[model samples]
Structures are given as C-alpha cells and as structure tokens.
Target: MNEIKAMEKPIKFSDPLFVTLVASICCLLWGSAYPFIKLGYSAFDILAEDIPSKFVFAGYRFILAGLLLLFLFRVMSKRKFNLSGKQFSSLILLGVFQTGLQYMFFYVGVANTTGVKGSIMNATTTFFSVVLAHFLYKNDKLSKNKVVGCLLGFIGVVIVNFHSNLLEFSFSLSGEGFVIIAALIFSITAIYAKHLTGSIDVLVITGISLFVGGLALTILGLLLGGRVTHFTLESTGILIYLVLLSSAAFCLWNLLLKYNKVGKVSVYNFLIPVFGALLSALFLGETIMELKNLIALLFVSIGIYMVNRVSSRKFSNTLES
Candidate 1:
C-alpha cells in the first residue's frame, strides 16, 4: 500500500534522463532475450524445424511470467485482482495481436531465416511504432527529427546485416515476410496498449494479456504435437530467465508508454537489434568483431540521441511557454 502510494506520487517519467534509463533497460532486457531463447532451444533439444515446440516453449515462459507478476503486484499493492468487462476485452485484443499473432509469425519467420537477418528485420517495429503513433494520436504527429532518426536507425539495421548477397532478390511469404508482419502487429498493439493504459493498471494489462496469449499458444502447440526433449535443471533455469525478462521488460515498457509519448519512447526499440546481435554472438559463438557491427552501433547510438534530443527540447519549450 505504501509502495503503491509512493509510486503514484510525482516522479520524473517525462525527464529525458529517467526515460532513457527505463526505456534503455527495457530494450536491453528484450535484446538479451534473443540469446536466452536460443539457449532455451538448445537446452530443450528443440530443433529449428520444430515450430510447434517453439510455440509451446514460449507459452510456458510467458504464462509463468504473467502469473508471477500478478502475484507480486497483488501482494505489493495490497489489492485483489479485478478487471472490468472492457478491460478484459482490451486485454484479449492486446493478447491476440501483441503475443499470439506476433510470436506465431516471429517464431516461424525466424526459423526460416538466419538469426542475424531476423534480428535486423525485427527492428522494423521501431519504424512501425513511430508511423502508427503519428496517425493514431493527435499530439504525436510526425516530425522531421523523428523521421530522420528512424531512417538512421533503419540504415543501421541494414548496415549490421551487410554481407555479400545479403539481399538476393528472393522472398518467402512465411519467412522474412511474416517477420515484417509480426513487427507491424507489435507496433499496432503497442499503440492500443497506450490507449488501454489510460483506463487500467499497467501491471494488470500486461499480466492478463501475456497469460491469455500464452494460453492460446499453448493450446495451438499441443494440438500440433509440440513437446520438449528435456526439462532438466539447466533448461529450467533458462526458462526462468526468460520469464523474468518478459515480466520486467513488458511491465517497464508499459509504464513508460503510459507516461510518455509513443514516438519518443518507441525509438529506443532500435537498440534491441543491436543488443540482440551482440548478445547472440557472445552466447552462440558467432562472429561479432566486424567493421559493419561497429558502424551499425555508432549509427544506432546517434539515432537514439537525435530522437531524444528533439523530444527533450520540445518538452523544455512546453514548460517555458
């Protein structure tokens, strides 16, 4: 009760420093998920071809994460879990787009493409979020700085994926194509979530949506004969890490969005791909020390700086005016 009251008190959610810290943490946690998920796959002996198994595995992680969050929040806030009919409906929509459909496409798309390519492709979510926010909200109109920052981030993604014959003019609808679709879904749902936060608790919204989406995935996976080869201590630890990541990342992200403009906060998403690629290299023993990687990081860093600098100036001007 005390803690909840303290949180409700004035805080620096709009301050550039606070937003950068929280949003960067959220993106980094999500970025680390790439390596952790890969480790989970290996630990469980889940083959890349076993798409159903991937779904089941993701389902368990998310469901457990959601439950853990709900329990923690209930205890901390000294409140019982309750939801209105409208909140429930909003959560269902969020689950459908943010988790169920997004992951369905992402898992399948990743299975068909190289991990490097997939990570780069997933960064498209940043672009989607910015564009969607511009159209969806009266206050979050598109700006030249936003466009330039996003373009630089996109260019960084491409640079990171640079290699001979990287864009060999061939496309698969279910592979790379589906990954882009997942990005679009995530972006749209993020905007929806921003709206929902106006009426519901952030923790409630995140936990319920995760649980609902995970349940849906679990049912689909079971019907498709998904199964893990092992449930050993190591694999269990990996699963726990994933659960923690999902809980922390989603919760923090929701809170951030609740208090901040989508475009300003969403641009940090570009860093996810940079972190994913670097972490994957560390954990999977893939190559990381490349000229392109360094250049990509530089570009991404600049993009983040540009986006936030413009946003902060606007905020400062608002205060003065």
Candidate 2:
C-alpha cells in the first residue's frame, strides 16, 4: 500500500529577493528623477536665457515618454493596438489624473522650489496613499500599525520641512502647495490602480495611460505656445533618461503590486525622500543638515517597518483563511 502525499501550492507572489530587487531598482530610478529634472531645467534655462516654464518642459517630456511606451508595448507584446471601450475610458481617466495633472503639479513645484526640497515634499505621497487606500478600498482597513506608520512618516516630512525652514525659508508656499497636490494625485492613482490589477497587464495599462496622457499634454502645450524652440545635449539626455527609467519603473512597480500587498509595496515610497536627499547631496552638492536629515530618515524607517509589519500580518491572515 502506498501512502497519499499532499501537494503544496505554488507561491502566487514573486520571491522575496526578486521583489526586493525590483523595489530597490524602482526607488533608485525615482530618486534620480529630481536631479535629472534639475539638469534639464538648467539646460532649458541656458537656451531660453530665462527659466523655461515648468509646464512647457514637462509637457514635452511626458509626451515623448508616452510615445516611447506605446512603441515599446507594440514591440514587446505584439498585441492589437486597438483599445476596448472600457479600456479606452479607463486609460483616459488614468492618463488625466496620473500622468497629465500629476506631472503638471510636480514640474511646477520643482520649478518653484529646489530639487532637494521637491524630493522631500514628494515623500508625502506615502502618507496620503494610506489615507486614500483606507477610504477607497473596503478591504483596506486602517490597522494600528498602519496608523503608527503614517504618523511616523508625517513626522519625518515635518522634520525635513523644518530643516528647510531653518535655512532661510525662501521657498515658495505655492511650490510646496503644488507638491502636496501632486502627492494627492499620486495617492489617488495608486489606490485606483489596485482595482485594475486583475483586469489588465501592467505594461499594457501603463503604456495606454501614458500615451493618452502624453497626447493631452501635447495639446495643452500647443495651446499655451510652449513650443520646443531648441534642444541641447543635456536636455536630450534628461528626456531620454526620464522616459526610459520612468517607463521601466512603472512597469516593475505595477508588477510588484500585482504580486505583493499594497501596503508592502507602498513602504518603498518612504525611501524616496531619504534616498533623494542623500543623492541630491552627493550629485547636486545640496546641503545635508545632518541632525534633521538623520531624524527624518529614522522616522521614515520606522514608518516603513510598521507598514511591513501590518502587511505581513494581513498576508498571514489571508494564508490562514
């Protein structure tokens, strides 16, 4: 007589190491975005003999990125280029909210503020995501750990801003306000994306959304007379880098979301400000006020830890169920 053997289910999510690697790559790509934007702005300023409007620059870059994404989608997937009615509508909405409006706010914010400051402000996306997710998704309950994490992250944001204030506070309130708006948009996008996870391929959705978003920006740019008068090597490089890295990271980020819990993947956003500050210091020679920056990093780290802990508990519960 032979004994019966029970078979184990295969893991639905990617392995821990792979998820970590992808997340790190996404962070690094996103972290470098500020410096690249600064470089592009500098080049634009050089050519224009004055600051090129942020909206103008961002509008062009996003359109280019969107086109590139569509091209890549066609090459890689070889799927039909047509969109269904539902997909078309969803992509249009996503494009407007995520790519078009979000970047409009972010570029304007960065134009008004220093790259380092913009990066620090961008960290608020994580906190806002928690709030948005709580309200948007019935399954996404606000647990104690998540609440603590959000509070800790908010503290870090305050510390980072406080340090900036100590250093003369010359920053524009409008700029900071734009960053906050951008964060809110991103949070909304993340929460909305959670609903789309099972319905479409991440790359497909990203490409379509970007293409549509880019087209809208292009139209707006044309209306505003934001013509590309000239392009330099630096501007070209920045555009290319932004398009490639952003597209790649967007794809990977979506993949991570599909495989992992939202809270777990979102913890990575906590690293954005911390890494962005350090990278800004290293590359752009921005001042890194040691005490405050360290405190902010600590808060962000604790927040991330809480997010992870809560996510793990939730995952375990699902497994048991």
Indicate which candidate wins on TM-score: 1
| Candidate of highest lDDT | 1
lDDT string for model 1 (1-321, tens) is: 687555533246777888899888998899899889989999999988999999999999889988888887798887986788877888988986788889999999988887657777788899889888888889887888888888898888888777665766556878788899999999899889888888787788889888888888888888899986699999999999999999989988888888888999988988887777788888889987878778988998888887778778877887789
User: TM-score of the candidate numbered 1?
Assistant: 0.95
| Residue clash pairs of candidate 1 | none
Worst 10 residues of 2 by lDDT: 1-10
Off by over 4 Å in 2: 1-17, 46-52, 109-121, 160-175, 287-295, 313-321
How many backbone overlaps does candidate 1 show? 0
lDDT of each: 0.85, 0.69
- Model 2 misses residue 244 by how many Å? 1.1
Candidate 2 TM-score to native: 0.81
Query: What stretches of model 1 exceed 4 Å from their correct place?
Result: 8-10, 317-321
Instruction: Tell me the TM-score of each prediction against the true structure.
Output: 0.95, 0.81
lDDT for each residue of candidate 2 in 176-273, tens digit (9 for 90 to 100)? 77987898898788667656756765666777667666666667766765665558887787778888877887767777776666666776787666
